[model samples]
Target: MSALILTSVLGVVLLYLGLSGNKSILAPTAIVGLVAAGVMSWTGWNPGLMEFPTMLKFDQMSTLFNCAMIAVTVLLFLFGIDYYRRMEENVAEHYALMVFSLTGALILTSYTNLLMLFLGIEILSIPLYILAGGKKRSYRSSEASFKYFLLGSFATAFFLMGIALIYGVTASFDLAVIGQKVQAAPNNVLFLLGAFFVSIALSFKVGAVPFHFWSPDVYEGAPTLVTAFMATVVKTAAFAGFYRFLQMTAMPPALSDTLLVITILTLFLGNVVAMRQSQFKRLMAYSSIAHTGFLLMAVLANSAMSWSTLFYYTFTYALATVGLFIVLTLAKRAANGNEAIVIFRGLFRANPWLALVTMLLLLSLAGIPLTAGFVAKYQVFMLAIGAGFIKTAVFAVFMALVGIYYYVLVIREAFTPAEETPVLVVSPINWLVVSACGVAVVAFALWPVLVG
Candidate 1:
């Protein structure tokens, strides 16, 4: 626990350092700090506190999420190297904000109390609000920040009310104690309302349908790299907290049924809406929401393997999104920084390696076989079926097929030839980001994940 806290503090310190205009050291320092955190977590060294009065557990689950968060942060730092190269202004603040967000993410994964949970969410979100508006001169960026802040604050209020209600009933904010009360008598009306509110709060955080209104706008408005960070690292951390909440208190029968209905709706809506998107960034945002629905199904699986499934799915999904976003940034730069789907036309002819990398990433997102996305989706289906939710799993599989179609269209554009070819050159940093994601996705699919 001390080690984890140290890591979180160090990230905060790095952010302060970044604010001092030291662009050259920002990414490297963050990478090194994340690497250290990963190493400490891997060694299995930490205080065994039922942290925050038993609301959070610093056990295997928290450790797994910590490691994943650190890994993602490391990759983001690498991508940030080139992403921020030309932005001479606010360089320090940008890097610092990232570190602060990462610290919140770490806290989120280890939260033990409802108060801690809410704190973690705020810590994670406030920095992102600023990061979205990092481009001070861009109207779209400012719009994105404003939209995100308003929606995020609304969600946070809902979460706070839920926490208050839960505390009112149980006279405790500790998750374990709350779970005990729920299990003792599962039909309490106020408890059920609290649970529903909590679910809605987290669902919004992960961008589930009906509650996902801000994602596309924010993703489209923010810088490509910032969008990637929110989609991947911030999301994984949010889900970690959501997962803990579910595991601590199994939903009552009524709430469980409601979640089942909501999950199905989210999956359908996410896929259906993504099909009509023309902007690559917005498409990815909608697609990410769809992916979130798939993950929610895994969480609903309620099996021994749920944790491992969530961890692996998040890693692979993040791998694809992180890589795809990196490609989008570079491709956008090549096309005078446009975000249109057509910007990728003739990509294969212009740069085969980059195009192929993009193809693999899209393929993974679409859950095509031989890629991590396929394996991740397969695990989700198996978990759902194993839990006797065959109908829900079947519908999810159908949606998965639909998902493949849109992603393939993106690949088709990448392979299409342009009437007049233009030269494309990519930074080594972007190339490294693409290559790392490609390798990690394939590697995880081939190996048995450590989480079991």
Candidate 2:
């Protein structure tokens, strides 16, 4: 609770700093506050306590996810220092919006009530709608923001309707009470419908196939930094909430079958479509959707180790994504913001170290052996097979192979010689971030227990 309050206050403080014309210290201030909030979250670790009339639960799982979110946000803010260097106006608001969005993420990790869940989703999403349009002068940005708002609103309606149906049946919005009701009447039609609705809403939130049509355009149109935030922190929060809800409910077999179908479709569509993408951001958008499929598989397995597996997978994935997007930003600038896959050609010749780090990040995403991505993917597959989803696991493996083809395609471009020298503007901080993420991916792979 203190951590939540602290993060909310930090957002307000950042807003005040923006209003006060002290823009220089805004990033530093936000960073310090996030660190403090992270520490506060640890202090509550394993407390097994509930706050606000049982609306939020402070447990080891929540604490771990909160800390991971904070860690990723810190890295992003560090990158933002360079990414936002030339933007003279509204810098502080950008930092504040992220902090506000993060406060919602913290809530998502801990929420124990349906009301809190809805609030958390809103808090996490509203800011993103504005941030998506941060590049206000761009038509694509405006279109992205509007499309997101419309689709997100529809999803939220489904979520609320599901909650209402569950509340009608359970006579409470509390997860524990709802769980008791669900267990008591597992075969209730309204209950199954409610769960199905909730699942569809979350599927949309995580960009699963059939619900993922909005992601590529939005990712391509939004500012790169905002896209990174959506891909990492926002996705993490959505999955956390998703896993939490599923863990609470006694999932009906019908809902499980639905999830199975969605997972297969997501894996197939995300990987197969990414093969033909020429735009770099669009490719990554599809890549993000592909990863969502893997994460959903973990949820389907629903083992005792599910949370730990998810935490490790998301943490490592976020690290690689943040690094790759930073590289992409630099590459985009070098190519005059073209965002073409060909821009990466001759990256090795221009700067071998940067190219190498980028390669490691991409390889991790590709699930190459001896990297964090491989460990993450291997764990998911083992869990799926253990849960008796052998055929699904086999299909997922094929999709992963397709994923590798595209990732290696980009790697080949990076290693190949370019027709002309690409002018990349490398900031020291960005290089440090990319290097750190690359090393962390390798380090975690070698010592998976450390993350757990």
- TM-scores for every predicted model: 0.95, 0.97
Best candidate according to TM-score: 2
lDDT of 1 by residue, 194-214 (tens): 888898899899998789999
Note the Cα lDDT for every prediction shown. Answer: 0.84, 0.91
Task: Point out the worst 10-residue segment of candidate 1 by lDDT.
Answer: 48-57
lDDT of candidate 2 over 186-291, digit per residue (tens): 8888888888888888899999989998999999999999999999999999999999999887667888899999999999999999999999899999999999
Give the CA lDDT, 0 to 100, for residue 425 in model 2: 82
lDDT of 2 at 51: 61
Model 1 per-residue lDDT at 237: 89
Every candidate's CA RMSD: 2.1, 1.8
Looking at model 1, the pairs that clash are 1-47, 15-96, 18-92, 55-112, 56-112, 332-337
